[model samples]
Target chain A: MTRDELLTALFPAGCSIQPGGFGTLRGMAELPGTGRVEIIGIEAGTPLGIEGALILSGHVLDLVAAASRAPLLVLVDTAAQEMARREELLGLNEALAHLAKSLALAAETGMFTLGLLYGRAAAGAFIATALSTQMLVALPDAYPSVMDLPSIARVTKLKLETLEALAQTTPIFAPGLEPLFATGAIAEIWPPEALAARLAATLAAPPPRADTRDALGQARGGRKRAHDIAAQVMAQAAAHG
Target chain B: MNAPGMNAQSDYYYEASARERAQGLLDPGSFTEFMGPQSRCLSPHLAQFNLTGAFDDGIIIGAGLLQGMPVYVAAQEGRFMGGAFGELHGAKLVGLLRAAAAHKITAVLLALDTGGVRLQEANAGEMAISEVLRAIVAARRAGVAVIALVGGRAGAFGGGGIIAASCSRIIVSGHGRISVSGPEVIETNKGVEEFDSKDRGLVWRVTGGRSRALLGGADAYVADRISAFRDAALAQIPNAPPFTLESLQAEQARLSQRLAAYGTCRDATEIWRQAGLEPPAPVADLSEADYAGLSRLPEADHDAR
Candidate 1:
């Protein structure tokens, strides 16, 4: 189905809708006349540069706080942030962190957060949205990794020729589902054909653990020590308190 | 000039390489490395996309001593992807910090020299960095002194800047610059015509060591010289052998005041000047003895009221 058709089915019958930045449909979706609001929207990366991600994140936060939603639906179609000298300098990482904080704060304050990574889920901007949520569903086409090749060569100082040879065998350093899966950094990787079904299933399931991402790491053997460490930290804090 | 019998102090000393800096920042030799060069944790994503590089994922994390003080140190190697943190790199950092906190290490020093999260590994890198932040916060709760040392050429830009900002104490070299967004980003987002990224003075004025120090972001500003950094680290040891929430809260409050003062100034030099500190031009030119003399000036009344 087309993007709009997918969004139309997700919205409540009477909730008003409007176009947000990047041509994504945004509006409140809730049961009729309840006045309770659930901000729902879809965003694309091709427009707004990568910096647009921050703007999109900010708008979503404002909508949620203004509407006081219990669960928020985020539909992502980012190919990743634009690679520009300016984006790096403006401290996109902090902007990215700010978005993460918003979602976390919302989660702590009793909001259900879900993300559908419809496209490229590359870089911090991409991860910030999905990782901060209770569940993340990604389309098969998504190409996720820390960065591209030339940038890596420029910084790591390795001869590009050498990087090519080594990448062939090492999934740990490669992008896509392999590395994330190995690290248990991602909880679930869904196919494009079955995304809708998966999303419905996840939404139907009880809100998973506070951070299923950490548990996913252990269950999948991607990240070796995240859960244990988090537990240790909490234990220490509790003992002190 | 290199005569064998020369007793010159310069002859006996040599500058530390990035690797050596990473090694020496910790204990004499207690560093047990994971995913180091031998482990070959180079980025698979970068290579898949046709980038080339070497070493253990562009970061160095291990345990060592800082003046008999047991500690864990993470030195970001900017030479590698601007010292960006990718999946493995971030994992290593988070893992080590986790290890340190779990074991209750005396301190954690981050010799940050990054442009932030590596782009090739962007997705994982970003998550890893956030995880590390949460980890540092957790570490601090266990009385672990977290020191962010920013002196290397990368100067802790990008996401690394935020991580540095959240540290218990930030130790910076005069040449270092720490900012949430780098000047280039400002120029890009705002416009190059409005701001110049090439202006060294402008960059320093905005985020340099003296600026950070005056702004109260850096707990102390030491000379760019490595020995000065070592000395400053030693000085902090006596006062804070173990990190505690109360101690960190006090430091955080102090940092808040430092940040607030920036609202009233345009440049670090001006902030320092207002703080009664000798400006950087003169301070940078001062001999070790002269600089020490200036540093010993009666403590200014800038402490939070």
Candidate 2:
């Protein structure tokens, strides 16, 4: 879906979104039945990178520090982070880190942080912005993964057909919202039509902060070792103490 | 300088393995790995692809003594999948930070040697790193100093770089490079003119320890030797400041000033010049001590702090 269409659907009452270069969108909008909240949404086709991320995350930090403690909603739709020489040279990782830190600071300040993944949330873009939120929801149509199949195939030196066959049985190598949901990376796979309502409910009563994705992944049989590894580390730590 | 009774070959931080790095950084014989390779806690995701996984999932997390002070240590093994964080790898990091916070460990030293989240398990890896960030913040809130040392072949990139930033302090060696995206990724997407991935010198100049320090992204620059890293880590851990609103504000101001000053900069040389430094000696030629002597974060009012 286009940025305008998604924003309109999500905020029917109207939102103030301004498009920046490289598919970046910035602005603020009020949550349904709640006070004004800050919005940093990246349209689906946008190729997010260091410069765009800095602008988006800067706004988040500004809004969080503002007098109003309105919740912050991060709209994700980017396919990948811009892989440019200038960005890497300029320390894209640091820019991405800045974004993560901003979101983290927002959560630390007791501001409600919600992420709505509506499109392709892949790799670095997903890590920098979306994953840090207190509550993260994905639309059914969202394609969230680290790297796409072709890229994965290239990196692993495996045939695309082989990876595709593997993805069919294991969500581990699959691309889409369902596989992500199986891993518990996504809190819910809400339909596009119900996004606004779901968001409203989320903002009204933000879920308590906890890292339960590991357990959820275990229960779903997608990520078997994460929970157990974390448990072992904790247990060992306790034992040492 | 080699540690007492250690071979000279192990002196270099870049040459050390993740386990060796962890053991060498801590006081002699003080390192007790929590889930060492013996634990067999490998990445299940890699197993699905029929790939052999490291027993510790590429990261070593445990408790140890730094200068006789109780501390926690976590080091990433770059040889294992470029030290990437898969689900299990990332979980171990998050678990370590969380434990450090709970135990109120006096300090936590992280030896970062990854290119960021493992692409195979991207979402879970990202989530794990995010959890680690939260835990780092929590540890800092509880007065536990969190320091990151980046000096491995992979350096620190992608989510790893971000995680390093979130730490209370960052120490980098001359050979270490830290950035979000790798050079090859940039070259593939932006064309060779944008960033020639083959030009190692150019890559280092742009994202190397010297540039990161000058850019206000790193706190200290040390020699490529493990002893230097240990010394720098020791110097900072004892009195590492708590993460407070005021300190965060100061950091925010510093970062903002960096963007304002060098946001438009394309060349690392120009950045150094603009930051009021002399035409920099080749970044590769500068010793850690020499780099440390140079002014860092020139845009910020360091004296005020």
Best by DockQ: 2
B1-305 in candidate 1: lDDT tens per residue? 11111121221102334556655554445555544577565555566556686666777766666666667667777776778777667767777777676778777778888887765555456667767765665576566777788887788865687677546567787767787556775565567664468977667667766545544456677766555665666665444422322332333334334434433454445555665765445544556456445542122212210
In candidate 2, the residue pairs with backbone N, CA or C atoms under 3 Å apart (3 or more residues apart, or in different chains) clash, namely A93-B180
Residue-by-residue lDDT tens digits, candidate 2, A137-235: 887777887777887787888789988888877776577777778877888877778867877877788655766778888898877777788888989
The C-alpha lDDT values of all candidates are: 0.57, 0.77
**Model 2 chain B lowest lDDT segment of ten:** B296-305
lDDT of 1: 0.57
Q: Please give each candidate's TM-score.
A: 0.61, 0.92
Best by TM-score: 2
Q: Encode model 1's per-residue lDDT on A1-241: one tens digit a residue.
A: 3455445544425456676655455565554333344554445555323335445555555654554645676666555444443333233333454455555545544566776665555554455565556566555555556555565566567777765665555544456666566555556777655554565566655565444455566566555444554454334333432
All models, DockQ values? Answer: 0.11, 0.53
- Candidate 1 lDDT score at position A47: 31
